[model samples]
Every structure is written in structure tokens, then in C-alpha cells.
Target: MTGAADAGAPLLEVRGVGKSYGSVSALRGVTASVAAGEVLCVLGDNGAGKSTLIKILAGAHAPTEGTLLAHGVERQFASPRDALALGIATVYQDLALVPLLPVWRNFFLGAEITVGRGPFRRLDVAAMRRATRDDLALMGITLRDVDQPIGTLSGGERQAVAIARAVHFGAGLVILDEPTSALGVSQAALVLRYIARARDRGIGIVFITHNPHHAWAVGDRFLVLRRGTSLGEFGRDEISLEALTGLMAGGAELDALGPELDRAASARDPA
Candidate 1:
């Protein structure tokens, strides 16, 4: 949707990354990189290794082969906390929010700010409330009240809050796993707008989704995977929307669907 990234170094890079479980290969020799202010959309159908890729990037799993580089240096992330320490944040579709908690409370759920010292410390509720309000406002997300239960918000709004929270917590790379999958068309558009807002603020985004149209709407680069392997990765200029869709469905597979659909249409003709 925007111009290519500034040609700066990637904030995160995966070089020939692979993961395996016993004899089952979940990911094989996949490679991609995302620079600051860029959106790299990873598109694939089920069993395409997208989940494995997310776990590796989020440090939930370690790669059995190849390398992961952060800011051009090779490093291993032993846990999710290890990756978070380096400003890598992953926002799953469920959002990991407590539906019963107020927006402000949920905003600072695990990482609450505190006042006073030692045994006298107390939750800085007012500070968190204001921060939650103002920060979401800056991300173009205007909530009616920070006191409302987060579950009352629509799917898109909840995802926006998660994205804003990640950015506020100083995450440089935000990985969104199917953030728009459950939303209707209008709500999905709202989430896409939030994603663009994140990119404009100099955050690298790895947007993983099965919908090529959703990914195509905001992606600057595209990566396709099939059956646990990397089909290819292409820049925005190098790939078209049609080509992206075809590749995600597998070129030959979609071609086979065309004639069957044409025959189905003819069978329904009154003439």
C-alpha cells in the first residue's frame, strides 16, 4: 500500500530457517526479512508451516536448522520472554486479553506500572488509564471509555488495542497472526488501517494470513509457503494480486478448479 522500505537493514531476518518434529518437517528452508517501516505478508493455506514459523519467530520453538538474525547479529531466543526482551511481540488472533477486565486493566495486565516503593507500592491505575486512552487515540483508535470491558469491543477494535499495546511497550517488530480472519468486511478494513498506522510509525510487521486479498491490501512484500516449504518470496513490484492468489492456492490447483466451475455454471443454465 505504501512505497518500499527505505532499503535499510532488516530488523529481523530468517535465513534458511527450518523446523522438524521427529520425522515430520513443519518448516523447511524458509527465508524472509522485514525492515523497519515495512510490511511482509506471509500467505499460505492450512498446513503450510505458518504456525511453525510464528512459533520460531516468537521464540516458542527453536529452529533445528539455519539462522535467525536480529539487527544483523545471529542470536538464539530461548523463550518468548527472551524475544520480548529484544522488542519482538506476537499478537495472536484471540489477543490474549481477559474479556472480563476493563480496557485499562487489560492494557497493563502483566506489565503493570507501580508507584511508591517496596511493600508500600500500589498499582498506578490513573496513570495506566490515561496512558491507555491517549496511546490508543494516537493510533487512531478511539474507545468510548477505558472502563468498558474489552470484550464489548468489536474484533477489529480488540486487535487495534493489542497492536497499540505492543507498540507502546517498545516492540520494533509486531507479528500479527490472522488478525482479520474473524471480522466482517468493514471490520477487517479497520484492522488493516491499524496495521498501516503501525508501519507508518516505523514498526516492522510480519502479517500471517490465508487471505491473499487481506494481505495484498497492505503488504509491501509477499511470501508464499506450501506443505511446510517456502514457495517463494517476492517484492510488491515483482508480484501482482492475481499471481499472489494463484500461488497461495497452488498454480496447478487453481487451474483445475477453473474448468470444473465453468462446467458447473453451464449445468445451471436454463437454455
Candidate 2:
């Protein structure tokens, strides 16, 4: 496992990071940082380059420009395994889980616990179940059965399991890609609570979402993006939920359309 980062340096830092594909640029000069025990929320609309940023951070793609620093030292990730080796884990919207597999199975999918030697080696089912239950409990998730199919759990519960798996395996930084996008209010709140729980445990998180309310609920800092460019990075005290919402919805553009919208409304009502 990687050691603690230098004091005052973020666990992960992107300095002027940019990505391009021949004639097109997917990201440009975007910068952000996530420190231990901090939640850095990345907010943006559909085409705001959030996916692109996640890919770069996850080592699925290389940036065309700028530097990525882990533990205050500059480095480039060759693949997802490289990022994983540095204790960086990403949980995307699809979750990469098998619907038929039990909760504990999915929790230790790629990294399973085993016992014995050579040909006698076998999966430690009991140990995995115990650890899965204990880890999820640490995140305030109490499952009735870790043996149930993962698909049997609610959306929020599945997300919580993914997070617990990352934390259990020593992930220092976790990048969550729209984990609560498709859930209802109560379900979304459950995931947000888990996020806070992870933060309290001193894990760095990059939470990507389009919802300002969700972001504000667990974020220590906010980074707003639009059309592949970064608007700015703000601390919790530096920005309000309202301002963040306005930015996500294009405040200037909305202001320009307000008069036209009012005219249209009056014409339709004529009252």
C-alpha cells in the first residue's frame, strides 16, 4: 500500500490537465485536487467533460497536456492497474458488478481472498463473507445477507458496497461517476451518507454529479465544468448551492433567455 502523502499536498492533484483527440479537445487546462478526508465534487452538465475527466483520472486515457501528481510526486498512469496500484479506485455508473453473483462475491470480484497452497488453494468464502459484512457495517450499511444476489439490493446499497470494497482494499482516492444519477431522493441520500462516512474515515473522493444539492451535501470543495472547460474551483464557503446550480444550468445563458421565455409565457396565457 502507498504511504501517506506529504503534509499540505493533496492525495491526488491534476495541474492544468488537458486531453485532445487529433482536431478535438475533450478537456483543457482543468485542475483540481483531493486531499485526505476531503470530498471534491465535480459538477457539470451532460457534455461538460465529466466523463473525460473520470477516464483520465482512472488511467483509461492519457492526458495530452499537464501533470498528474500522486503523493506530491508527478507520475502518469499507464493503465487502470497503475492507478489501482496507487490505491485509486473508480466506481462508474454501471458499477461493474455481476447481477447473478452474491453481494460478497461482487465485493471481492477481481481481488478475492484465498487460502491453502499450490493446487490446494481455494477461495475463503467464510472470510470474505465476514469481511464484507464488517466493511459494509463500517459504512453504516447493514445487509440481511451477504449471500444474496447483488442485483437484489437497492441502487444505493449497491453503490455503498462498491465504495466499501474500494475502502477495504486500501483505496486512498475514490472517483465516483454519477453514482446517484438514476436514484430517487431517498436512495440518493443513502449514497450521499455513505460518501460522508467515507470522508470521515479519511478517504479522498472525487464525486462527479450534475446535482448541486447532492454535491453540497457532502462536498468540501466544488469544481464546476462546462463544455470541456473548468469554470472555477471553490471551497464550500466560497460558493452557495444556488450559485452552483446556476452555474450548472448556465446562468448567463439562462439570463439571456429569461425575457424571451417571459414573452412566450404571456402569449400562451394572454391573462
Candidate 3:
């Protein structure tokens, strides 16, 4: 494996990635690339290898076969922490917020700020609150206050907070798994707005979702997966929403279903 700053580098690239469990193939020869400040959306139906692809990228599981290049260097991450250290962070659907904890506390949970002298060092509550408030506001998420419990925030707000937290923590590449899957239409829209905000901040994002509409809303590039393989990948310029939806749901099969149904109806007509 090469370092992340090698030649012909993409901000993040997975070439010919494959994953298998015993005799089951979870992924097969999937390849994709995401550049800086771009949103690469991976769209797939349930069991279409989306999770497998994400795990590989997050370094949760090494691809049975493939090369992962970050910042142009080939690298293999031994664990999720390894990936995070390289500035890659993953936000799963759960949001991973401690519901009982205060918003500010959850924001700075593992990486708390401290200040004061020597043994007197104490949690920098004021600094963390002010920063969290500002960061969330910058991402278009307004909180009543940072002292409230995280569970009080809407799903979209929670997701936005997670995104802001990742960006503030120096994540160069953020992989989001179904960030909007559990939200309603308007709530999902709010989360999507924050995703765009993150991209505007120059952090490359990999958005994994089953909703083509949501994917199209924030995606600069699209990769459609099916049956553990890539159906295709297209730039926004190369594909439309209708085309993408058709592909994900089996275009040829859909086309054939209509005509076959029409033929059956004609045969049943009495002259």
C-alpha cells in the first residue's frame, strides 16, 4: 500500500474493491472516487452492497481485494480510528448521540475541551457551548440553547450537529450512511441542506442513501449499486433523476412489465 499523497491521487478512491464472507459475495469489483469538495452519493436498494461498500471505506473491514487511495496514496486502515486519524469520519443512521446528555456534552464527548492551570484543568464549558452554538448556526441549525438534552433536537438537527462536529474535528472526507432515511420529507430536506453546507466548506462527502431524490439533491457524482455490484456511476451532467430511479429499480424489467400487462389486458377483452 502507498501513502496518501502519491501520484494520480483522488481525495479518496477505491479501485476494484471486493468483499466476501465465506462463500457469500457482499461486494464485487466496486470502484468509485470522490474529490475534494464534492458529494459522491452511493445509491442502492436494501441488500445491494451499500453497507459493505461503506464498511470498506470506513476501514471497519478491509476489502477482500482492492486498493484504497486517500489523497493519492495507497493506504489500508487497521480500524475505524485509523481512518478517523486520516481525516475520514463516518456518521451512521443512529447519529450516535447520547440522548440523556446535554447537546454541548454530546458535541464534545470524546474530544472535550479543557482549560485552567495544571491540576486545576477543568472542562471548558463556556468555550465548548459558544463554539457548538456557532458551529450549528453556521450549518443552518439553530438550537434553543446548548444546555438542552440532545434527545430534544429533531432528527435533522441531530444529523446536522453530527456533520458540523465532524467538519470541526478536521474530517477531510465524511461518509454518511442513510443520514436522512429516518426523517420525514421536510426533515430530510433540512439535513440535505446541511450536507450542501458541509460541501461548501470544502469537505469531500460520501452520502449513502436509498432515496434518489435526496441523493440528487446533494450529489455531484452518483454511483448506483445492485446485487453487490455497481450498476454504473454518473456525474450530475450525465444522468437525470428519472434515469437514476429507473436504473435502481430495474429499467428493463420495468419497461417489460408495462407492455406485458397491456398484452394481458388485450387478450382478456371480449370482441
Best by lDDT: 2
Q: Give candidate 1's error at residue 260 in angstroms.
A: 2.8
| 1-271: candidate 2 lDDT, tens digit per residue | 4465566789889999989999899889999999999999999999899999999999999999999998887879999889988889999898889989999999999889999999999999999999999999999999889999999999999999999998899898999999999999999999999999999999999999999999999999999999999999999999999999999899999999999999899889666
Per-residue accuracy of model 3 over 1-271 as CA lDDT, tens digit each? 2353754456789889989999999999888999878999999999999999999999999999889988877889899998898789999888889998999999999999999879999999999999999989889888878999999998899999898888888788899999999999999999999999989988899999999999999999999999999987899999999999999987888798988888988989665
Instruction: List where candidate 2 sits over 4 angstroms from the true fold.
Output: 1-7, 262-271
Model 3, position 11: C-alpha lDDT score: 74
Better of 2 and 3 by lDDT: 2
Measured against the true structure, the TM-scores of the candidates, in listed sequence, are 0.93, 0.94, 0.91
lDDT of the candidates, in the order given:
0.91, 0.93, 0.91
Question: What does candidate 1's lDDT look like per residue over 73-181, in tens digits?
Answer: 6769999888887788999988989998999999999999999998999999899999999989977988778999999988899999999999889899999999988
Model 3 residue 114 distance off true place after TM-score fit, in angstroms: 1.1
> What's the distance in Å from true for residue 8, model 3?
8.1
> What's the distance in Å from true for residue 214, model 3?
0.7
